[model samples]
Target: MGFADYPFTSRYQTIDGHRLHYIDEGQGPTLLFLHGNPTSSYLWRNVIKPLRDRYRCVAPDLIGFGRSDKPELDYRFLTHYHYIREFVAALDLKDVTLVLHDWGGPIGFRLAQQEPRRVARLCFMETFPFTFDWEEFPLAARPLFFAFRRQRLSYWLLQRHNLFVDLVLRLSTFRPLPRSVMAAYRAPFPDARSRYPIRVFPGELPINDRDTEAHRAIEEIERGLAGMPQPMLLLHFHPGAVLGRSRVAWLAQRLPDLEVVDGGRGLHYVPEDRPERIAEALEDWLRRRLPEPVRGALPAARVAAEDDRFGGALTWTFADTEHGGMVAAWSSHGLVMLSFAEDVDDGRAQLARRFPKASLEAADQGAIANLLAAPAATPLHLVGTPFQRAVWRALLEIPPGQTRHYGELAHALRSQARAVGSAVGSNRIALLVPCHRVVPRAGGLGGYHWGVARKKALLAAEGVKEP
Candidate 1:
């Protein structure tokens, strides 16, 4: 709805002669988010935004939904499954963390079963993990679901009035959506003709043990549930549409390695209702269970000769800026260290300790002042462990006028706040790496090596107002 909220680049892939729209953001381990009927990739915007800086988040619009082309197919369960299977193959994604909801559960579960090695873990909300007998379905939802199966009436309501987007969607959410959000969901199915897939979705539900193709397909997919144990997480809420209390209990009994968290209050559209809860749960679970592989340790020979790699006399200089007095140093490679210092002699001693192997020389103060003014312009000879280097790189991505919570940065990096704080504290490059932009999530300016006052002053200079 609002580009400010869902600000991600749209991408496309041609699969099965149709242009399938998707959003692929960030880089690292993959988090492939799949949406059910009515909702599209837009369903995951808020969830994706917080995690994208650390993990690669990919959400695709199904062939007949959202920005994807609407081909005139039967839009049956298997048909949608086949398209999604092809879509995954086309992308060649590996070791994926599948985040599914509603119909997405069936599609993603089937894919995971077919290729277990490719899928790393699974997290779902209000998903269809098994076939539902009429009694198993939520009592409140039965009437509308029954109406959806009554061929002619379903067509009249779903297609003619677009009831799925209008009535059903509105009623499903615990909270009322803004007009603009409703419009975004409505944008996909503009007319009756374009609503064919929406009309077909209801009939695809495997209900009442009926002798139908959908039931048979779901039966086959359900058969693999007990065995598909890849660290599953169930983010359930009170009185969800199909995934109610009884059904959740049934699922817990079947799915192994299962961890359940109450996602506060929500209805069918939990993403819209509790996106922050979803994001936090997912970030915590993923960090604990599927931690990113640590970069390999360097060989002994290389570690011994680390200083020789950047062999040359390092130069140092000091500058008095509006914020405070600053000490800056540069090696032949680039700016090696920069920090705010009250005492010039003590700062010099600290610099020597940081680079004990290199010879220190005096440099022009003007050159160091210009580098401080435009930090990004100068190259940096960052010396730290692989993880610390990663934290430094993440620090550079923070926009000048913005600040990130330590926990937020930690989650983004799939690490704990203490670990992130250690990495941030170790940063020697100061303004060039922008470690001062990090703050405590609980609302306070966190500790700064230079001083909290200097951090405040630096932020104020960049137009960032602290809460």
Candidate 2:
């Protein structure tokens, strides 16, 4: 097997009287791999190897693909979705980042919609999440769709000849796969009876038709993108197989929080062509957003879906505001810094000065704004003296529409008022830790590190009058 160098643990779950097989390896939060037609979890070997150090990798053979049971049941999109959903539930996979491709897009996204709490982030490639009419289909891809829908032809080709694994993937992939790799792909379905899932995927695609369940799945994805939001990344090649230039743009418009990246010159099977690129993108996004690998089991009963926004480390994002511009950052570590009214470069520089040696990345403006607008429950990573950290924590306890004086805070911490003021000024992260809630004991508003005017505006926004 190709996985000799990167051996993975074999795991299985019985779902719907079929033995669904999957590979579970590594440690920390799970990264679930969902394969499309003709390919199994074996498609993700390259991707899993690189990221196993930081992530727990779970790649499943979707009942009819790899080592999983290929039941005689009709393998429809809904059937696959149910199997995958039950698989996730059975394993209790939480705080998940779905790495999806091909049919996996509809299956994964639809699952996210059904169980909104289960998924945290999504990474997709060559997978369409929106519905399209026949006219919208690419001219080159049109024939393939027509061919797939021809039931007798598709069945003979897919089930009898295994044309998809033998020919289609070979043609779409950028480079020729090794003989061993091809064997791995074909290993599961040596005969027609074993290829039912692959046989079902193509016809299930909603082309020029709306009534199809798969079509409804795409529409559901559209609604899911609108109603609920999470970090998403769309990966595509230059001359795309599925997501051409116009289609990517359409997807961008639909998913405003999406992070777009090029997966180089590849066709639909991006995992085969650009595994490293996908790995790098996943690493960069997960590192910035996740910040740290999960060190231990999450406390019991804490549903991973609960804090799906970003991990507990300090994650930062850049945005433009009426007040010049903003470089807002957060992580599992709460709002570390919000440097407003500064040029992007200057803001990042200021952040560097405040927390030197911290990893920072420029996040999508729209995505960061959504997070900042509705702050998540994350602990602050305050790099200050014990007294200063205590002061910041106390300030966070201050209710909105109320203000605390330096003397009052000092009395609470049993420290000098001057020292408390100095600590407040030293507080690097703003808004989240609520340093602005601390005011002066005298009959005047105290100075603020960001600015007195901004401070006043914050107090006003919180419905607090300077007392």
Candidate 3:
């Protein structure tokens, strides 16, 4: 369908002297959509229309695309990010649920990271942060990106010819893009000069440290992901050009609260191919998180064969401790995380990062509170690999008063000591998982995920004091 076929209100704001266009429809909590290369707010035509009645849905054309003013400036990844940050600020958006694809992922991620309070929920479709060694690229596509370094030839394909609209987009999308939609996509870049942003995008694919800004942002995004408590939803498609099966799984594994829904027979342009499924995926997740009562107009339709509607919910309680306070969290499976620190926020942040989609709340005033008040023995649901799980079980085997060095557990598991140390570092259940019991063989405590002083206190409480 053409942009006109799916109608909505079009709005613009002068962000940094340049007018940026966006689709702003519906009302109530804001749901912001960010587009990538060769596409603009038009990409979200199908997604925004369906949920406009109950929610204020927005799809913005990045500076160079759609009706936005295409300024003649060096368009780097950071440049796009600054514009997006300014767009959100200019509108003074609050409690935003971000729907991001392609370049939008990194741009939106950095914005959310810097201002966590403004953003509440996120939906990632056919996207990955720019990090990792060049060798880590998916085997099928490595050659394509590797060859993109030949800037002269790549620039010809991007600027001289309408390769993205005429060839790449058509190839990437599953559904046929009729003449009208093609005309809409081609409408922006009437000539080579306006397509400079597209020219820079391909070569700017952050491989290794080559794209320094992207590389640093990737590292920070990956690192910050482990701390960001926002609930995330991922739409995993069959064949994205770069984001393949392995990349999707790796991302899902890291975010404790990420729910993955299958986008059938779709590629990198999954948004174009499967907009109905995409809308449903966001709608289903928002139903659970939306504070207001679910309205009738926003009907919940189940999307795809693989339903990822459930996850990232945690039942937690806080109790006063001698050192400070402890937060105990439990999943439906069992007691999953136990943590002691100065306040409950540390544990909450950890659980939020680990189970990004899980609901976290205070335990009722009863036995649950008693459990949080003290380290009540409960069956643990460990979060890790087989080796990590085995290492944690080994730690649990240690008598409360006794301690084991990293080497001792490694030898017992018949694995490398570093592997044991890594697992110890990742332990979620803390005292119950008993990772604090594992220490350095040399002398002083090796490390603790919580704190060295807390580790010492736990050890001292059990009879073995920290060196």
List TM-score per model, in order. Answer: 0.63, 0.67, 0.63
For model 1, the superposed segments whose C-alpha errors exceed 4 Å read: 1-4, 292-467
Candidate 2 RMSD to the correct structure: 15.1
TM-score of 1: 0.63
Q: What ranking emerges by lDDT with the best candidate at the front?
A: 1, 2, 3
Writing each residue's lDDT as its tens digit, candidate 2 over 18-109 gives: 89989988887679999888788888999999898878999998878789988787788888888999999999886688999988888898
Clashes of each: 0, 9, 12
Residue 10 in candidate 1, Cα distance off native in Å? 1.2
Which regions of candidate 3 deviate over 4 angstroms?
Answer: 1-4, 132-148, 209-211, 292-467
Compared with the true structure, all predictions reach lDDT values of 0.80, 0.74, 0.72
lDDT of 3 by residue, 182-282 (tens): 88889999898888787777666667647476667767887787555456778888866657778877876676446677767787888788888898878
For model 3, what is the error of residue 250's alpha carbon versus the real structure, in angstroms, after optimal superposition? Answer: 1.1
What range of 10 consecutive residues in model 3 has the weakest lDDT sum? 297-306
Question: What is the lDDT for 28 in model 3?
Answer: 66
lDDT of 2: 0.74
lDDT of 3 at 160: 82
